[model samples]
Target: MTLGLTGLLALGLATSVLAQDYQRPSISGIGAVAQPEQIAAWDIDVRPDGLGLPVGKGTAEDGEALFADRCAMCHGDFGEGVGRWPVLTGGHGSLTEERPEKTVGSYWPYTSTLFDYIYRAMPYGDAKTLSPDEVYALSAYILAENQIVEYDQELNQDNFAQIEMPNRANFFADDRAVSEAYSERCMSGCKAEDINIVSAAPELDVTPEE
Candidate 1:
């Protein structure tokens, strides 16, 4: 059977309707359709504006204890990073160095990132096992260790958006207006910029050599 574009579209629509009618899909042997609760469990999206933060509050002091107990084995007692593990603090003036050490305080541009990452992926082997309150505590502790937040301050969804990252001011809008070619080119006299010769084929070299 030869299927034209219209036939192919009809086939796709029929397949969609079949998928809707049947709870389980069997074409590729995907046996189950996710329930709303299942989808919610996996659909964790932390917005940059801190809108999707869960209802939970915690303090840096509370976070320090949690971090020491749950995270220190991999992250170190002070967020200095365990041996061969990720470092989460310091490196404030190292971006210009030959081998820059980018820590959470020195490079990350948002407070939400700290909350989101630790909530989703942390404690090395265990991921997404921390409760919302525990995640908030861990987030606050890391922020305090990196000197972004006071060790006594409580962090929650209400105040999370107010927390500013140290690298926030460094990022500016990318404006390539001057770099773009918007008008007709002056092929000769205006061509003063550096030009790299990308390839050379001796047989295809048609220009006269001076």
Candidate 2:
């Protein structure tokens, strides 16, 4: 097609704009490097060995009121969970049952996970708002509710690693690499038996009809 004067000018302008965008100098110093203190603020992960636990202490007694105030709406008074929310207590020795009730006391392999999770995320809409002491208190309360710790027993960084989960022995490192069966990749003519279709989608009445 023959280009009109206006079309030619528009095309030239677009090409020039594209060329300018491609050749534009990169921006410099848009943001400063993060300071050590600033990086420390976000590096708040607590390890299984209680390495990153902050200096603080609290008891289940202190946590009960805090739980009611900050967490009861969804978690219930005793951590039985409200509606569809997660149940935090009970479910002991139920792992072998047909339907296991996995709770903190029942299935969690580490207590550090509980503390870390509560600290990083909790209180529904508001996350990371709880203080270190408050987090300890909440952890203690949940532990107490699960009968893992006494109600008045204080929890701190020093003794936190000593508290073990009931299901800790059940969990182990993945051994699929060594334990599971591995074989060479198979393509065509791998199976000795002939393949047969058990049923069709139409016969099973699973396909939607127009």
Candidate 3:
């Protein structure tokens, strides 16, 4: 029997819905499986040993122009940082000071972090917009400004691992599981004695009254 136009359209819509449902075999049947290419696109994390660095190369000189055009507004002309932006250079030996300037030169434990961060998120609002070579250039420029690498030193996947960060020695593996002593779970009486209040919110005049 020939079906009406409306009945044919309804059957087509129902078939399409069933096809989509069949494609989604997840436990909740909410989404389809991510393809290999899609997973690869997001697996861009670089390790401290330069495990995931892409095939590309750049030098500080190559990055100088890029930094000026793309990064100078926020990071300053030489990684010194703008008004309230983070300083990226000249914080050496200041980690012990009252107000330590934890710039990339002084505190970062690996050069890979620089490459990874810039590749993942950077240039303020425009994130993941830089090419591999551009990221390498920027990383090299920052390293040069921090005195970690020479201005002409080339950075690439091969030599990326050799460029060690100054603070690498300061960072150790998390040994809390073995180093820290775990005692019995204490829900009550965690403190030695009863708590005493020296001041109240109303006395301090910090709380609003209804």
Clashing pairs in 2: none
* Candidate 1 lDDT over residue span 82-170, tens digit each: 89888999988788899888888999898888877877887668988899899889888888988888988999989986888877887
Model 3 lDDT tens row, 1-210: 889999999988876655446765557867899999998999888998788999999999999999999999999999999999989999999988999989899999888888889999998899999999999999999999999999999989999868878877887889999889687799987899888998777777866668
- TM-scores of all models? 0.65, 0.71, 0.69
- Across 1-210, the per-residue lDDT of candidate 2 in tens digits comes to 898999999988876755446765789979999999998999788989998999999999999999999998898999999999999999999999999999999999998998899999987789999999999999999999999999989999999878988899998899999999698899879889989989777777877768
Off by over 4 Å in 1: 1-36, 172-210
User: Could you tell me which residue pairs clash in candidate 1?
Assistant: none
The segments of candidate 3 whose C-alpha lies over 4 angstroms from its true place after superposition are 1-31, 173-210
TM-score between model 1 and native = 0.65
RMSD of 2: 7.6
- Model 2 TM-score is 0.71
Candidates in order have lDDT scores of 0.85, 0.92, 0.91
Residue 98 deviation, candidate 3, in Å?
A: 1.9
Decide which is better by TM-score, 1 or 2: 2
Best by lDDT: 2
In model 3, how many backbone clashes occur?
0
Residue pairs that clash (backbone atoms under 3 angstroms), model 3: none
